[model samples]
Target: MDSLIKDAVKSGTPIDGADGLLNQLTKAVLERALDSELTHHLGYEAGDPAGRGSGNSRNGTTPKTVTTVNGPVRIDVPRDRNGSFEPAIVPKKTRRLNNINSVVLSLYSRGMTTRDIEAHLGEVYGAAVSRELISNITEVVVDEIKAWQSR
Candidate 1:
């Protein structure tokens, strides 16, 4: 692990970008977590004898592109024969992850405009987040604040 980081640094790899070390690390971690989730759901690891006669076994994986804080990561989400394995790290049909939302909200709280947040995300993280998406993410917090005030 230390050698990998040293090599990445020696090669001038950027910290955050599509092909950067952080993105690669994030992708690896998420994929590993998803595989763990599938194993838990199936009650056995891949190639285990216990999975031979199981009603629901490992089928394959589906390619999914998820917008994460590092950038958009293309991961092969593991699937099951019963089609009931739902991953909590990258939930099904969730294009954007929560960390990016938190970043947007943190920027907004610091008085950055939606457009500014959009440009910051694009420039810093290489994530093409639009102003509307930033607004929508912050809107949820706004609603919660309003509800709290009303209460």
Candidate 2:
């Protein structure tokens, strides 16, 4: 497999069997994996910003390092959007501080009490996320909720 991938890369073949790529299966799998990873990490569909009116409004640049359940991801945040486009993984305004979004959401969905969720988070991530904080995070999704409902 390694040799196949190396050969394909050396030949500059498109991974997805675009032209005449070798190890098409491996390439396809990798492509899908990358897509899934980006979706899981970005929390928004690729190229789907919340608002497309004014573009990303930010100062020179907003640098943030987020530690998701998967691992740490560093991203440059935009200052502002036309109105407010908060990316689910590292909310636009929040600047990025480890993705507790998934953790909080998962715990809540699993029927764990708020206190239990807080303790679990503290034990795993060394930070205690209060129920209030969790609620605040979730509140940001109201727009998404509305969109879903409308749909």
Candidate 3:
């Protein structure tokens, strides 16, 4: 598993898209890293002539702050059964399981070039990832690194 992760990172695989290697990290690793779930009342509405009162939404969200050795990430979690739940880390609207941002960060840490990363993602993940996007994802660490350095 570790070697696979390293190879993916070195190759610059985009974490987006369904069943991609990077996406698998999210489902198999990140989500399970801090497995948590919550349920809340969505609120109630008056009844209609045809039926009883309705609810605004059956799901309630909880912002889960996941702490990792690298840093922390805030993941929004929605609670619902029947496969209606949507979590920000793995959104309901998305078919992918992994976080592209996380994949980029991992790759950047491993010293992969943006162009290399983009190409790797295209070949391995079947996604056309741009070098600019790879840079942007790594750029997010600038402030955090600076703060750590200053400290």
lDDT values for all models: 0.73, 0.47, 0.47
Writing each residue's lDDT as its tens digit, candidate 2 over 1-151 gives 4555566567676644324432333223222332333333334444666424433433233555544333344444443333343343344445334546557666776887777877887898776455655554444443333332343
- Per-residue CA lDDT of model 1 for 46-128, tens digit only, reads 89998888899988899999887667988889999998877654678988875655577679999999999989888876776
Model 3: C-alpha RMSD to truth?
A: 14.3
- In model 3, which regions exceed 4 Å deviation? 1-92, 95-97, 148-151
For model 2, what is the error of residue 47's alpha carbon versus the real structure, in angstroms, after optimal superposition?
30
* Candidate 3 residue-wise lDDT, 10-72, digit = tens: 767643444445344433343332222112122222132432233233344456554433334
Q: C-alpha displacement of 132 in model 2, angstroms?
A: 0.8
TM-score of each: 0.61, 0.36, 0.36
How do these models rank on lDDT, best leading? 1, 3, 2
Using lDDT as the measure, which candidate wins?
1
- Candidate 1 clashing pairs? none
